[model samples]
Target chain A: MAQLTMVQALNKAIADEMERDSSVFCLGEDISDKDGGFGGAFAVTRGLYEKFGEERVLNTPISEILISGAAIGAAMVGSRPIADLQYGDFIFCMMDQLCNQAAKMCYMSGGQVKVPMVLRAPVGATQRGAQHAQSLEGFFTRVPGLKVICPATPYDAVGLLKTAIRDDNPVIVFEHKKLYGGKRVEAGAIAPVGEVPDKEYTIDFGKAEIKREGTDITIVANLLMMYRAMEAASHLEKEGISCEVIDPRTLVPFDFDTVIKSVKKTGRLMIVHEDTYSNGWGAEISAYVAEHAIYYLDAPIVRVTTYDTPIPFSPVLEDYVIPSTERIIESVRQLMDS
Target chain B: MEAKMLLEMYEQMDLIRTYEETLYYLFLEGIMPGSIHQSHGQEACAVGMLYGLRKTDYMASTHRPAGHDIAKGVSVKDMMCEMFGKEDGCCKGRGGAMHTGDITVGAIPANAIVGGNIPISTGIGLSLKMQKRDDVVVCFFGDGASNEGAFHEGLNGAAIWKLPVIFVCENNLYGASTSIKNTLNIEDIALRADSYGMPGEVVDGNDVLAVYAAAQRAITRARKGEGPTLLELKTYRIAGHSRSDGCAYRDDVEEAEWFARDPIELLKNKILKEKIADEQILADIHEKNEQIVNEAVDYAIEAKEPSVDDVLLNVYWEGD
Candidate 1:
């Protein structure tokens, strides 16, 4: 095992998948180049163009609809395509393709066709303003046919990406901009440099990883917020408030068992996400835990998420809006005090 | 057009017209489940563009997909079953009228949203190229769909990659009730194809031979790795856009002018003028196709509905 950044792990996963499957290919804007293409907006696909060549590492125009819809069509045929969107906010441009075409093709075709394509987009408020910043997991998780995965660490990124590429359905991998540590670094990035194995490995969906073991409270988070939750747990430990941090890697195929077990142990649940609070992924978790594990919980479910407003361009407001370590700690303290 | 091809297209056109007429009557009787996007007065464009295509080749259609699906060789009985929401339907009763298709015959499920299938065609072409196959994909849309974001993006992508895809815009002179004259500045939708650096041709959609010849050139260019070509079939929608539309927006004079140039009527006249087939042979073919549709209707009415146990099946692909 070696320490690799999330971007490096993702690049390795794509290269490995391309090498393993001849039908596997990638298409996006500025993703292809023999001499180190833009490697995508976050440099995740760096050097894939030279290794896989133009046929596999195709460079498309700045058309999100075409990128996504073309990937759906290619996946409908024989090829397994990995389509990349420069930013997650651009996903709205291909909403028809993703929510309608890709999501309904298999069902609409009576299970005759399989759209085995992967759409990778860098999500989260990275100070790029409203047009570029948005956590799209909530939008996609509500979609029945599409699988949504958000890997925070390098190990999960490589493993889940491989699984997503190999899965026989449309999978959307929402990579957090702050977690992607490479040549380009974000202003307030917390690079989760975990050890990724050298040998091929795949992490299955619906399995939540417990980041920190504790017995006071359970914090369920994913993507960048997962790191924030861990930091909150570290801070809360000093004040005699132990918190168990759980990263439910995939929002669609959620590992509720792990979350339930953690909630049962702690007797408290606090769900956090970078998405807006209104109808956020955290709300779903809160509801599920309330319905199933309510008897075990000693306190009401607390949710820490972004406000129901657009991500601000100003760093101060953005930081204030997004759930920070202090906010998570304060929420934990309130739950403890209550 | 050759006699064999001409007669085949005529028979298919007749079948589509009869099928559409039958559906119109059925919908009027309140027997149909969903709203209909009938493709009347545009049979020549669908038949002429799809009749020459191989069953292995792919085609994506708009909401009005019965003509294209039938032309692309989707089973009549399955399409009927789908319309009836029967278990034996092409999509196992999952897809209703608007989303009709049989992937086994290379007709992707029809896109109800306008211009939704254009970029999908580009991807299908990309897949064909990646798989090292010569098969081409044809994307059928309306003049209004040409203005959608998917159209520009899909066409531009196909052009740059030289993907084997034909973007067929059935300029039926209307985007629903809105007139093309008011919506678009250009008279011909083919002119927009120039923006993508591909050759665009405008064809007389009322004349099957003209549409057939134009489609042949586009298909040939695509097969030769020359890139995509846009074919604008200048046609008109004789029927309302949907079931609720009364077509009050269309003037009687305009309707008569287009009705006089009906594609089926035009094709029949051409066949008779060229002495391709006698009146008896044409009548016999029409009678046969009508009988087929009649049989499909009967089968669909008698087909079984999906069981309660299977209400959960075929949502996500459980591969073999």
Candidate 2:
């Protein structure tokens, strides 16, 4: 085992997958090493171009539609491609390619083709204003054929991404910019470095990882919010309120079993996410828990989410808009009081 | 081209015509389930461009894809079953008229979105290049697709990488109801290729041999590791854009002029004039192709409906 950051782990995962499978390649803007280029927007792919050469690590023009469509097409014809987008907000530009082409190719072709591809996008409110900063997991989770995964730590990043690369379906990996603990540091970034195994290991989808074990209440979160939830759990422990924290590694093939089990044990549930409240992924989890484990609940389910507004540039307003550890504690206290 | 190749092209064109004409009547009688964007007058474009392509070479098609699908070697029975929405359909009844294809024959499922297949075809070309294979991809779209952002981005990517993709534009003068005259400011759609630094050509879409010749040059260039080519086939659709669309938006004089240049008739005349085959041989080929379509229709009508239990299947590929 070796201690590594999330971005370094992701780079190693791609390099290892490409090394194992010749058909695997990387394509996106500024991913190549020609002319001393940086390895993508977050530097997760920094050394791949030099290691794999230009054919395997291609640098595309600023064309999201072409990048996505090409990935789908190449995947359909026996190539496993890992496509990258600088920001998750740019997915809107290639919605037709992702939603119509990649997502539906297998079903539309009557099980005749498989689009084994992965799309990586950095999503978080990093004070880049509305166009650049948005947590887009909610949008893609609603899409039927696409699988959505958000990895918070270095270990999950490598395992989930490697599994996504090998899976015979189109997967969207939403990596939070604040959680990408590499050289490029952000204003409010939390660098979560963890030990990743040197040997090959893959994490199956639909399995939730419990960050902390407790009994009073269960907190479900992912990406940046996962770390925040852990912090909330630790803070709540001081006040005699034990909290259980759960990070759902994959959103689409969600491990509802783990959440249900945690909720059963705690008899209370509170969801936390950086995405906006209205129709966010938290809503789905709330509804599912209500439908399946309502009788186990001692209090009504609560959600701590970003306000229903675009991410602002001001640090104070941004922090206020997104969920905070204080908000989780307060929500837990309210649920405990009720 | 050899006489055998010329005859094969005519046979495929005849088959597409018969298949489409048969579907037209069936749809009119309310027998078929879904709507069709028929390719009635654009037979030569599909047959000519796809005649000699190997089964490993990919072809991406747009909404009006029957001719292109059939010409690219999707079986008559599979397409007919697809039209009937049966379990034996090309897409197992999930994808209807606009989305019929067989990937085993190198036809990616036809995209119904206007210019959706352009960038996808470029990706297939990239895969072929990366695999060190000499196979090429032919992408088919209408003049309406030329206005899409996908067209510009797809063409530019293919040019920069020198991917072996042939972007074929069948300028049928309409994007559904609106005429291309109102949509495009330029006279030639092929001229847009200049922006991407690729060779572009215009051909008589009604002439099968002309389209074949242009396709040969483009395909050969692509096979030699030269960049993509944009071939604009100036044609017109004799049928409406879809079911129940009357030609009120089209001028009678323009329609008459294109109708007279019927691709099948042009091929028939050429075959007889050059003595490639006698009139009796041409008649036999048409008869045989029509009979094949008739048998396919009968087979589709008797094919089984897809099981509801399998409706949730194929949504995701579980394993090998």
Candidate 3:
């Protein structure tokens, strides 16, 4: 076993897949030095070009539509393409290609065609402002034909990415920039390094990871919010508040069973995310629990999320907008007191 | 070209026209469940470009795709059933008229979004080139798509990769009511290829032979690894953009002029002059096509509507 950042773990997963399957190739802006920039905005594909060469690790033009559309087309034929979108916001430019074309092809072709494609987008607020700091999993999760995977840990990042590559349908892997834990010599950085396994393994989708187990209340979160939930739980424990922290690693085929069981035992639930309050990923989980696990709940399911507004570039404003440890603790205390 | 090739092109154009006319009637009667973008006057472009294509070769179509789908050899019965939203349709009743397609028939569904299929077509061509296959892809789009960024990006990518693809812009004067003259700066859409360093050709779209000749040259260039060619078929749409309106925005004088240059009438005259088919034989072909169209409608109406469970079946492929 070896420690790896989420970015390193994603690189490992892509490298492993490309090495194992010749059909697996990556294309995106700044992927190859010969073609220009240095392997993506966050450098997740850093040094892949040296190992796989320029062909497999292709650097495409700054055309998001072409990048995603090409990936879909290649996947349609025989190749499995892993398209790296530098930021999640740019996905809006290629929405028709991804949402309409790639997602619907398999279903439209009556299962005769399968778009085995993976879209890697770095998301989360890191002082990048409204355009760059969006947690795009909420938008992608709403789409039916595409699989949405959000990994909070480096171990899960590597495992889930490998699984997504093998999935016959299109999968969008939303990586929180903060969780990648890569060293940023820039002005501001919120990265946290984590441990990952060197052995080949895969984290199955629709499975939640119990980060911290307690008897009183369950705090469900994902991505960056998962880390905040843990911090809140630790703080709550000091005050005799037993809190269980659970991270639903994937959002689409969500781990509803785990959340339901955790709620059944704890009899209280608080969902947290970075997306806006209205129609966020939390709404789906909350609606599901309300429908299926309402009788088990001893308190109303409280949702802690960002205010419905564009993420501000100012660090203080962004910090105030995102789900914070204090907010998680406050939501937990409210649910517990109820 | 051989006389048989000409006859085959004529037959393909006839099939496309008949299919559109059939769909038009079905849609008018409100028998068809969804709206349709009829390729009523765009038969020459589809048949001319696709008639020279191999079955393994690929093509991407615009919203008006019945013509291309038929020319690509997608069964008329399946398309009709799909329009009726029946279980036996090509897309299993999931895709309506705008999205109807059969990958098995080398026709990627007709994308309703402008320029949506352009980059996808380039990807298909890239796949063929990567696999060392000589298969060429013909991407059919409207003149409106020429202004789309995807068209520029896809063409540039195809040129750089030297992928075997033919970008066919069927400039039928209008894009869903907005005329090309208003949307585009340049008169000839094909001339835009100069920016991408590709050979651009403008052909008489109503003249089936001329369209076929241009397509043959472009397809040949692509097969020889000369990269893509932009073929702008200066054509006209005899019908409305969709089921909604009847070309009220279109100039009546211009409409009458294009009607005189109808691809079907032009092809019929050529067939008669070339002695390809006598009037009796042509009448017999018409009778047979009418019977076939009638049978397709009957099959579509009688076909079973998909069950509720069918919606969840093809969402993903489980190694099948």
Of all native A–B interface contacts, model 3 reproduces a fraction of 0.62
DockQ per candidate, 2 decimals: 0.81, 0.84, 0.68
Residue pairs in steric clash, candidate 1? none
Q: Which stretches of candidate 2 lie over 4 Å from their true place?
A: none
Poorest stretch of ten by lDDT in candidate 2 chain A:
A31-40
lDDT tens readout by residue for model 2, A98-180: 99989998898889898999999999999889888999899989887899999999999999999999999999999999988
| Clash count in backbone of candidate 2 | 0
lDDT of 1: 0.90
Question: Could you tell me the lDDT of residue A193 within candidate 3?
Answer: 62
Q: Model 3, chain A: how large is the TM-score?
A: 0.97
Segments of candidate 1 deviating more than 4 angstroms: none
Task: Report residue A259 deviation for candidate 3 (angstroms).
Answer: 0.1
- The model with the greater DockQ, 1 or 2, is 2
Instruction: Output the TM-score of candidate 1.
Output: 0.98
Which candidate tops DockQ? 2
TM-scores for chain A over all candidates: 0.98, 0.99, 0.97
Docking class of 3: medium
Cα lDDT of model 3 by residue, B1-320, tens digit:
56787777777777777888888888778878878888888898888888867888998887888999989988888988988888888878888787777888788877888899999988888778777888889999999898899998898888887889999999988878898778988879888889889999999988888888999899999999899999999998888888787888988789889999999888888889989888787777777777888899999999999999667886777585
Q: What value does the TM-score of chain B take for model 1?
A: 0.98
- How should the candidates be ordered by lDDT, best one leading? 2, 1, 3
